[model samples]
Target: MRILIFGAGAVGRVLAAMLSPHNELDIAARDPKLSLIEREGIFVHGAADRKIWPGTKPQGIYDIVIIATKAFDIIRASESVNEFIDENSTIVSPQNGLSHVDILTDYFGHKVILAPTTIGATSTGPNSARLVSLGMTFIGSSSGDMDREKTVAKLFDHAELPNNISNNIIGEVWTKAIVNACINPIAALAGVPNGTLLERNSLLTIAEKACYEAAEAAIVNHIELTHIDVFEWVKEVMRSTSENRCSMLQDLESGRRTEIDEINGVLIKKGESNGISMDVNRALWTMIRTAEGRRLP
Candidate 1:
């Protein structure tokens, strides 16, 4: 398969490394990292060690276009790669949150696939990353096309990456988003790793409040999450990636904008639309935005 991945960040690099050996891979990224990838190739360390594909700018239409950009950059990433999409091209977005699906569907129509992965990875440098934890990835269609879902599942299987096809990907996406909404901002604000949220009672309390709020919002929105115990799921993730700094924490520490709006802020908006109170989410959203403002010039 010919694949083009946008945003050579942690997850992008990880996916590129995973799929490069089995498929034709191209990475659409900005320089000087682009030049570095072209020169040094993508290297994975820690849990796995290998040199993946050398990055290149995509030209012709590709079999698959993976949007790994941050939620805020999805529009730009999709537009930038629009020329590379054709009728047969399958666009997969593994981005965190719900809004990217709407954006991708709007642009790519029924060709869009929603892939939400729990694999933990962190970028060590421009063209290098470390795998923190390997977890199941769920691939499915928002439109419920089982054949297309199975096709994408086969691609992951061929690459030896763990994945499953789901009839309800939107539910899975919401479940992951709820977990992210609980842990990410709390970790960022506390300046701690994921496990720390579970370790500290005060922090865990905050996360629990956010989790239930998000759960209520999901219920109101008619999203049937697989996890009956959301808090337990969050705890499992914290334990699994104990030492790993979440994406939100990494963004804040590096002085980059965090996806507070897409994660927590989105929950808050949904809560409002559903006539539910998301005070905890609202508070976390405000706090993170304030911290981000202070980090700015």
Candidate 2:
């Protein structure tokens, strides 16, 4: 199978390394990383280890196309993938929030698979990524095609990518979003790693409130959560990846646009519509927006 992973940063680097050895893999990447891969190949370490060379351009129509860009880039990224998609292409989205779910589904219909990975991967440098924890991936289609869902699951299994075929993928996706919504924004605002929240009661309390707010919103909206208690799951993630900076923190520190809108912004919309108030999420959302503005031009 030919697979193309668009956006070769962090999670994308780790995925390209994992999937390349088993399939004809191609990756879409920018400047130095693209040239670096062409010259030195990609090295993946930590939880999953591998070193493989990946092409910078697609050879032909890919059986699977993974849109690995940050949530902010989804709308534009989805449009660029059209050339690589044919009648049978499967578009996999491993994004963190539920925001990009409908956009990709509405764009590609059944071929779009909502895949959310909890893998704690970060780009170490120009040509490498370290997987802090090998989090499981949940795979299912927003269009609800079980057959295609299983097929993609089988493909990942063959590629040595850890995953589960979810009957309730939206729920699974929401579960990840909830954990991220609770943790990422607070981490970004506080300028701390995830583990720091564990030691600080104030931050942990804020995260828990955000988690509870989002969880209640999920229940109110009738979205089933795979995790019975989301805050516990978030704490476990924080412990396991203690030293790693959350993506939101990384984005904020680098002066890049954070996915607060993609993560918290979407949650606020859902929670407000459900009349959950979502005060915690809204506060973090506003702070992130203000920070983003300060970084602009």
Candidate 3:
């Protein structure tokens, strides 16, 4: 199968390396990055203990396009993939945040599969990614058809990426949203890895409270996520990914725009639309932006 990955970032590169062994893999990204990967194959460092780069262009009409861009880049990235995607093409997004599936569905129609990956890998340098935990990755279609979803499940399974298909994808996405609501901004604000706050009662309380507010907002939108349902999942993620800093925090450190506008900011707007208040999430969003400004010219 011909596979193309958009955004060649940490997650994209990790998927490229993992999938390249079994299928033909091609990666596309903006600017010098793609040139680097195309000219010298993708260089992966840290974790997995192997520096392997697949040296071939994916031929024929791409069968699957996996998009792993930041939430803010979803629209442009999806549009860019149109050249390669066809009627049978399946697009999978392992992006963070809630609006991504809807955004891709709007652009690529119902052929898209919504995936939330906790296959913990971090990018330590340009064109380099480290495999950390390789947790569960879930997939399903927004339209609830299982054909494409199952195809993706078996694809990842064949590649040893550890994934499954879910009928309750909205709940699954929102569950990850709840975890991101707590971990991403808090990690950015504290400048610590996600697991660091697990021992800090003060930070843990704040995080749990934020998760509560997000869960309530999601429920009001008919999203059906219960804090009781996702509490242990959240705790497990924190414990497992304790040493890694969130991508948002990494973006801030590198003087790039964080996806706060999509994650926390999207939740705030959703809450307002539902007559609910997301003051805590809003406050963290503001603080994150403020901190981001300080790193400016």
Candidate 4:
């Protein structure tokens, strides 16, 4: 099956290479990055494997369309690349935080599949990725179609991006959202890696509070996730990528737009809708946004 992977950033590059051996994989991205991939091939270095993509973009109707971009870019990227997708296509989002499914479903229709990949990757340079870690990715459909979810699961296993088929994907999404809510902003704000918070309970409490509030907000939307699950998941994520910098921190360091607005900011908005005060998350959101603003101007 022909597959088109949008983004070509760290996550996208790792995904493209991981699936390269089993299918016809194409990396569709910005010009310079695309040009680099076309010229030098994408070099993937890390835990499970390493390789180089020496050529070509996939053509025609893609059987699987994987989007690995940040949450903020999902809509515009989908709209811009609509021509590459046909009715038979199954779009998978391997992005972090919640709301990817709703946004994709709104634009790409109900055929969209939600995914959260734990395949940790980092870009050492433009159009280059290192597959630093391994973890299970979840796949499911928001429209409650088992067939679509199954198709995505089959491909994920085929490509060796370890996956679990989830009936409670909304909950899975929010679980990951809660984790990102705690880790991403704080990591960026303090300019530290995930493990840096391990002993910092004073600051860690701030993160924990945000997780509790976000979990509560998620429950209001019928996304059932317990605070314990949130804490355990975040702890696991930290241990997994203990040394790596978060994507949000990477964005801040690079002076690029961060997904804080989508991750924690999404939770803040959800809290508002439910008449819940996500004051701590809002405060972190404000801190990250201020950092983001500094880079912009």
- Highest lDDT model number: 1
- Mind giving the per-residue lDDT tens digits that candidate 4 earns over 71-90? 88888878866887878788
lDDT of 3 at 12: 83
lDDT of model 3, residue 215: 81
lDDT of each: 0.87, 0.87, 0.81, 0.80
Error of 1 at 126 (Å): 1.0
lDDT of the structure predicted as candidate 3? 0.81
The parts of candidate 2 lying over 4 Å away from their true place are 294-297
Tens digits of per-residue lDDT, candidate 3, 1-297, equal 788888877888888888888887777777677666766677655555545465334445789888888898998998778888779999888898887878898898878888887867777766777777677888988798789998899899888888878878878888888888888999888888889879898888888778878887888888866346565667789999987777888888888888888788888888878888788898898898898884311
Per-residue CA lDDT of candidate 2, range 197-284, in tens?
A: 9999999999999999999889888999988888899899889778778888888877888888888888888989978889999889
Give model 3's TM-score versus the native structure: 0.93
Question: What 10-residue stretch in candidate 1 is worst by lDDT?
Answer: 288-297
Question: Which ranking of candidates, highest lDDT first?
Answer: 1, 2, 3, 4
lDDT for 94 (candidate 3): 89
lDDT of 1 by residue, 30-49 (tens): 89989999988999877667
Question: Residue 216, candidate 2: how far off, in angstroms?
Answer: 2.1
**Which candidate would rank higher by TM-score, 2 or 3?**
2
lDDT of 1: 0.87
Measured by TM-score, how close is model 4 to the native structure? Answer: 0.94
